[model samples]
Target: MEMLSTISGWIWNPLAYVALGIGVLFTLLTKGVQFRRFPDMIRHLRSGGATEGGLSSLQTLALSLSSRIGVGSIAGVATAVAAGGPGALVWMVITALLGSTCAYAESVLAQVYKRREHGEDRGGMPYYIKYGLKAPWLATIVAVATLIGYGFVFPGVQANNIASSAELAFGVDGQVVGVLIAVVLGVVVLGGTRRIVKVVEAIVPFLAVGYILSALVIIGMNITKVPDAVVLIVSSATGKDQVFGGIVGYAVAWGVRRAVFASATGLGEGTFVAAAATTTHPGKQGIIQAFSIYIDILLICTASGLLLVVTGAYNVKDPAGGFLVEHVPGAVAGPNFMQEAIDSSLPGWGAVFVAIAVAMFAFTSMVFFFYVAQTNLVFLLGERRSKVLEAVVKAGAPAIAFIGSSVTADAMWAAGDIGYGILGWLNMACVLLLTPVVRKVIRDYDRQRREGLDPHFDPGPLGIKGAEYWETQKEPVKEPDRV
Candidate 1:
């Protein structure tokens, strides 16, 4: 456990700085597209309604948010607050604000280079890596990494939390819950992308809305303390608060760590789903994806963060052995922190209520996680399409879920962070190199819209090669005048 923490500390040591730099760079290069075009994102969301055979933009957004707005929104925020102090919420705001621009870059690239598979368009980091950079080897490496990281490592983290939370709140046996979850998850993934999207679209809003409303109620009850909470977040984030002034480094590092984990920004997760959506312009999906980041950080994560802070339901422990703010006596920190926050206002039922809600949120995430892994599994297996390999992955995912139930939470979290962190850097590097292409595509779309034309992608005009599908969007050549 100690070794894993030390290793993750090293990886995240510079990740915070690098992630911020990527966000800032894209924000400038895109001319702050996420902000100037914010209303446009909302407009695109309602416009791209998929046909009977296609995945709609909204469904894709739901699929991505199913995972992005899962356990991380609740436990991840609580974890950030516990480790980084109330100030962690401040970095989360910055990450979301700047990170949305980064999201637009990767998502637009995904749409531009998306591949058509089994009658559906699918794309992601691997797809763009192959198409944009023309690097098959690097693409394969990333595909395999996502398979291991999001597929196996992160699912374990979710299952571990589900099991622990259920046991604490309902006295349910963790193993039974794990086995049951695995069985259900297997049934859904075997149904493929359509089923996964269908399930998430129905469930994500219900889970998100209920959780947000609960947090809102708590915030309303403590309206007076909201100001102090906001002040603490800013001061501690900048290392100005006397209480957390000494831990500024910890605050920045952990804040970024949890923000990326919670929102999955810069990790190339959103790009895959953005690719699957049927849209007239790549910029449309890019804008839609940027908006989902807002929902994840500002709406969902902020709800949980505020509840924890406003109610004083968390404790901060310094590794050097002493209490920073011991609101809960002898608590080690986990889902219990947030549960206590709610319970402080509504005693007896808070733990169970949060447990159920986390279970729903984390369960949906696990389903989406499995879908992402299988998508990569298809990538790694190549275009040959082998039922044998597909079945193996299908069967293997649930088995791992059960196994994940038995693992310790600390190791599960550490393992997930390692996978998510490495992929984030690799994907960020790819998008950085392709920023020029992303820029031209957006300019093309914006110019067309400025002329009151419905936007459609035509990659040929920009001199970008290897856009096999999108290149065909251009008008056909007219052979010299007939005799």
Candidate 2:
């Protein structure tokens, strides 16, 4: 545990600045596409229909959101407030705003380089890194790292959160919850990508709407406290709050760290799912993905942060192993803070509500994790899919989830951070190298849109090499379906 924390500190400290810098760079290069293309994002999101080989834009978004809106939004936000104060939530918002650009760039690149595999669209960081940059060796390394991260290290974090929350809310044993999660996840994962897609699309919308509406109700009940909560967030973020001024640095660090974890912006997880969408133009999917960053960090995470601040259901721990503030005395940081916050207003309800939310959030994330790992494993195996290796992933993913549930939260989180840190560094490097290509693609997309025509991708005309899928697409692009 001590060693893992040390490594996590080393990896994440510099990564925060790097992620912020890359996001700023992408924003400038694209002339703030995330802002300029806001309307297009919504239009594209409600427009696309699923093809035989690809998911609809909305379905793809649901898949990515399944991963993005996980325990990170709830437990992660609580942890940020408990350790970094209200200021941390402020930085989280900032990170998401800037990071959305990174999300756009990477998703565009992913769509541009996607491949037709086993009768479906398949690609991500590995595909883009190899084909776009012409670096197969580096792509291979990334594939391995992705397999390890998603298959082994990350699932544990999600499962652990689910188990912990269930234990708190229902007084069920953690081990029992863990086993049930593993069993259910195994059933979904074994059914393959289409099954995962249907399940995620069904669950994500209901859970997200339910959780956000619940938060709104809680905030409405405590309407008088909203202004003070806002004030505390701003003051602490700017080092002006008397109680939290000393830990302002920690606030910035923790906020960025947790935001990256929550949004999965530069980690390249979205790229894998984004590549699977059926869209006429890659930029359409890219724009939709940038919008998802706002949904994950700005809306859901903010709900959790507000619940903590408005109800004073959190604690702040100094880096020096002492208490900065302890509103919930002896309460450790996690979903319990949010649970307690809800209970303060409606007795005996917080635990059950939060527990169900955590279970759903974490379970969906596990499903996405399995997909990503399987995608990378397919990449590693080349044209011949290995049934034996596939079986291993199908079995190992659930087994890891169960094992992770039994581990301590601190250890699971540290391991998850290490996985994220490694993937972030690799994916960012690839995205940076391919910036010129991303720029050209965005311009092509914008030109078509400005001419009042639905945009379509033709890599040959744009001088984009290695987009074999688009190069082979000789037919006219189909108009997207309206919602």
Q: Which prediction has the highest lDDT against the true structure?
A: 2
Error of 1 at 456 (Å): 1.3
What are the per-residue Cα lDDT tens digits for candidate 1 across 1-483? 989888888788798888888989988887898898888877776665664435777788888899898889988888888888888888888889998888898999998898777677778899899989999999999999888876767888888888878887988888998998898998898898778888899999888889899889988989999999888888998999999888888788787888889888899988778887777778888988889989999899988988988899998768577768999885546688888898888888788998898888998998888777877877776677888877877776787778888888788888888878898889999999999899898898789889998787777778888777677656521212111
Superposed Cα RMSD, model 2:
1.1
lDDT of each model, Cα atoms only?
Answer: 0.84, 0.92
| Steric clash pairs (candidate 1) | none
Per-model clash counts, in order, read 0, 0
